[model samples]
Every structure is written in C-alpha cells, then in structure tokens.
Target: MSKIESIFKSCLEPKEVYKGGKNIPASNKKLYKLSSNENPLGASPKAVAAIKKAAENIDLYPDQTDIRLREALVQDFDGQLAADQFICGNSGSELIDMLLRAFINENDEVIYSNPCFLPYSVFSRWYGAKLIDIPLTNPNYHLDTEGILNAITDKTKIIFLTSPNNPTGTYIPRSVLDDFLSRIPKNVIVVFDEVYRHFADAEDYITALPYVKAGHNIIAINSFSKTYGLAGQRIGYCYTTSTIANYIRQIHKPFLLPITSIEAAIGALNDKGFVEETVKTVKEGRAYLSSEFDKLGITYWPTQGNFFIVDPPLPEIEFANKLMEQGIMVRPVSQFGAPGKVRITVGNQEANHALIQALEKIKPD
Candidate 1:
C-alpha cells in the first residue's frame, strides 16, 4: 500500500526560477539582486515604521477577516468595491490555492497559458483539477483568448489569467478581455492575477473590476509584494463579488495574515508618495534597460511590467551563469517553458549599470 496520498506522484513542485540572491556567497562582491521582480527602492518607509510598531504586539493574533486592509482597498477603489467583496491572504499565491480548494471539484478543469505563473498549475493539480494549457500568441506573447475560449469544456471550473504575464511581461488587451468574457459560460470562474498592475502603463490594458461589478464570475488578485515592496512580509488581497469573497473567506484559515504583515500592508497602502516614486523608478528603469539591451544588440520583448524577457546571443542559462559570476542575480526562463530567454527585473541605477556592464562584457562573439 502507498504510504502517502496516491495523487502525490502526479503533482510537481513549483520551479524556483528566482532565489533572491541566495546563491551569492557572503564574501563575494556585493550582490546586485535583480532576479525577483521586486521594487528596487525596497519597502515603503511608512510600511517599515508600521511593521516596527506592530512587532511590539506579536503576542496578539491578526484579524483573519482583514477588515482594515479590505476597507483600505475599498477606499482606494473609490468605494466601487465593498469591504465584504475583498479577501486578504498571506500572498496572492495562497489566495490561488484557496480558490481552488473552495471551488474546484474533483477532475474539474482549470485553463491557463504556458509561461504563466507556476502556482496556477501547481495548485490546480494539488486539488485534483485537470489543467489545460494554451500557448501565447506568437511574437507578442499575449494570451490567446480565442484558443482559451475554444478550450473550455463543461468540466472547466476556472480560467486563470495573468496580466503583465510573468517571464514574458506581456498583457491581454481590453478588447480581447471583453470579447473573451462575453463568450465564456458564466458558471466558469475567471481569476485575473494582476500583482504587477501598478507598474503597467499599457494603453489598452483594463482591469477586470468592471466585469466583477456587472456580476461576472471574476476575481482580481493583487499583492503588496510588487507595488509596495513588501514581499518578505507576505501580504496580498483579492477583489471579487461578495458571494465569492465570502466563500474564499470561509475557506481561509483564521489568522493566516500575521499582525505585522497587515500593518505593513495598511501603511504601504496609505503611502501615496512612496508608491508614486516606486512606479516612477520602475518605469524609468524599464526604459533604461530596454535601451541598454538595444545598444548591446540583444532582443527583448517590450514589457508592461517591471521585468523584461531578453533573448541574449547565448543560451539563457549560459548568459545567466555569466552574470551570476559577476555578483549579479537574474532568472533564466527555461523552467518557465520559455527556453532561450532570460527574465531581467528592472533595478535601481547602480544595479542596472552593473547588469548592463556584465551583459556587454559577456556578449557572444
């Protein structure tokens, strides 16, 4: 008899594409961590202060309901969403798992694209849901909405969409999203993971909130990890219809969000200046990196998020290894199902300069 669950053999662990400079030695040259798509400026100063104060009350359990943070989101959305319609989790990743646990039935199907977030397939299989993967549109790497619409079956329970898609840094346009939604059966839940939304400045990009308000089975998951630079604190939330939110909240365990994490998220939400500055830095850094890539004759996708997928002259792993030897951390996209491309996160000026220098030095002859 098998000792563990029979399903364990079919489930694959998520690939660690980025390790946040863990590979660098202590005595090595100062590491310029540009692997994970994090805010180069670090967490908001106000968030740091709030976390320091909240640390004093470590003995107290967090309010699992996440009332304050939900209210903050509602206010941020200009009251279009209610507190009851928002649910907070340790991270957007946790929320993904919760949605699958609360809604996906055995053998039900979940559809997403290749080169998308790793957690979607991981959690879907963990819950015994069948996964259907669609390829991104060629050259642009946008979600193939027509392919997705064609893939849906009566057994399909969830459709996972990632805007500013990880590794590719591309997004589905508003027209595509609208048309796709119009065709999908209302019974299927659509989850738009927009953790990188704040950094997106694409002209045709639109959020899924309108569909949510119109009573569509849509949920938008966002995180403090990207925009607010609170990745280490692990706070993220989702916006959806109240009924769905209630279901997710019920599935959520009590006190999943720690006191310090919530406090830091709340402070980050309220800090407008810090957010604006972070956005500015990312926008500028993205442009600078793109230009540098051009000067070095490297091809890269035009990104709407804080990272780019560059095609270096050498294999991605080979290029990434060269950079790592120079104390630079970057992510290779082989495990993300996009071989020959390396994902480069935009960093502050010094880090960017270091990366550019490394790339130029290692340019294939």
Candidate 2:
C-alpha cells in the first residue's frame, strides 16, 4: 500500500462503492435502459418548463432563508405538514448521508433490513456505526419486525425502513408497521424511505409521515425522481419533527439545492396530470410484464414499486449480461445481497415489449 493508503482504516481501506442502474460500455443509444426505476415518460413537461425558466437565474445563489421548494411542498402534501417540518437535499439518497452526519457517533448502532438500499450499509460503514442488518422474512421478503425488535440495544440510534424495498419491492403493511412502531423504543429514530410511494397501489399501504406529527421518532423521505420523472434534476426532501428538521438544516450547508433543480421539483409538484399518467403507465407496464413472465414460466415476486425482481434462465450476472448484449439493461442484485435475482424497472410499452422479446429468445427449451 502507498503512503496515502497507509492513512486509511486498513479493514475498510478499499471501500466498495454503490452502483446505480447504468448501461453497458457500448449501451448509450442502443440499449433500452430499464435498470434505473426512472419515469419512462421523462420529466414532467411542467417541470421541464420550470427548469428552462430557472436556468436564467443561475448567476445568483440559491435561497437559504425562504425556500420556495419547501414552501411548495406544503401544498403538495395538502397541508398535512408545515413547511418548517420539511428539508430539501440534492436527492433522497443524500438525505441518508445527512441523517448519518447529524445523529451518528462512533459505535452508534445503525439497523436496517438486509438487502435494502445499498447506501444504508455503505453509509453506516463510513460513519463507523455498529451495523445490525436484520434479514427480511422469507417468501414475500417483507420487513422482519421481530428480528429487528430483538436486535435493538441501548446503542441503537437509527432504523431504516425502505418500504416498497429496492430489489424485492415489497412493503410494510399499515397494521404491521403500526405494531412495529408501537413496540420500538422511543429513543430509536425510524427513517422511512418512501421515495417510491407513488407507485405502491397495495390496499394495506400507508405513508408514515403522520407519525412524525404525532410525536413519534420517525422521518419520511420523498423524491421527485420516480413518478415525477425528475431523476436528472436530483431533488428530494424529508418530513420530520420541526426540531429534528432544524438540526438537519444546521448540519447541512447553505444553498443545498441548485436553482434549476428546486424550480423543476416545484413544477413537478404542480404537474398532477403528468404524475397520474406516469403512475398509470407504470401500472400497465408492470401488469403486462408480470403476465408475460407468467406465460414464459419465469419466477418473480409481485412488486408494489415500478420495478420487480426476475429470475432468468441463467445465473443472475450472466443473465444480466445476456440482456445487455440483446439491447436491454437490468440490474443484477448480487450487490443488494440476493445472488440469483435480477431487477427490471417497469418501462414504457416499447421497452417492456423489447425486454419480453429478448427473454423469449433466451428462454431454455
């Protein structure tokens, strides 16, 4: 190891990075990119217009005092929570990092479901937190409530609950989450990553934002990347108690969101028609793909989000590579710790049709 390497913690000297859904080396225009759960309809037209309008103001610094983005979110939520309770970050992913920075100390226990958003593990390691990753229950892959309740200790600080979980795409039912929340000690703050809330159509689903208002130690994070199709804009925010929100704001630097990103997200909130259409498209595409997979005798878990896990004809890595070669891109979830599974984002009709066609060609006789 070189002198620079010598200064790093030896056990974690070479950090494993989080990989996003991306195309292959030669994949730009050729591949149907369905790996990232982005809105296939693209960013809301209203958001695009807002971004164009905001681009002229790039010379000035972003607002730190009166954030129109957070102000706008009040109307978006139908006045469920006050503007003071919401805080914005560059993306929902960044809020996790901010949470860790504000609350975590050395050896503080950070607990989350195993095979969750990859960053939960990565950020915990970076913050020197004692990781307590509990495995999800078998079959449906929902949160293992008892396992997590058992794992808690006095050192436990944060619990990450990713509803419509990444890779598995399962969620915590309302009753199950209520019971779990009631049982958890008040000192431990539970973070709900509900970025994909728009796509979850399950009857039992409920957003945990109300719990924050009710004085529960909970935080709910939302993103504009999925249903709003503002992934390129990279804007997200969280709902927490005004007290916790204040602390996060203090820890976070000034002008966290770019002017264009803020304007785009604000516009996205007003684009109700666009959001409804995106959700409609994803629901249709999801049903279409599921029915096709059934006909091909492929095994996959039912998903509430815009993506689901698919077991292909070959091992996951090889299967993912094969799809890439055939002008498609899907994520292999080995990094998310499920070895045999591949994740496919529900795409537009054209893209979804192409994926099924590709799978048909590769299906074992």
Relative to the true structure, candidate 2 has a C-alpha RMSD (angstroms) of 1.7
lDDT of 1 by residue, 309-340 (tens): 88878877788889988878888876676877
Please report the TM-score between candidate 1 and the true structure: 0.95
Steric collisions counted per model: 0, 0
lDDT of 2 by residue, 1-365 (tens): 78987787643555767888774465355778889888989889999999999989999997764368888999998898899999889888898888988888888999988677898888777878888989888767978899999999999999999888898889999999889999999899898999999999999998877688788889898888999998888889898998888878888778778889988998899999999999999999999999999999989999999998877779988888788888888988888867788999999999999999999987789
Error of 1 at 330 (Å): 0.5
Q: Root-mean-square deviation of each candidate, in angstroms?
A: 2.2, 1.7
lDDT of 1 at 249: 79
Clashing pairs in 2: none
Which candidate wins on TM-score?
A: 2
Off by over 4 Å in 1: 1-25
> How high is the CA lDDT of each candidate model?
0.86, 0.87
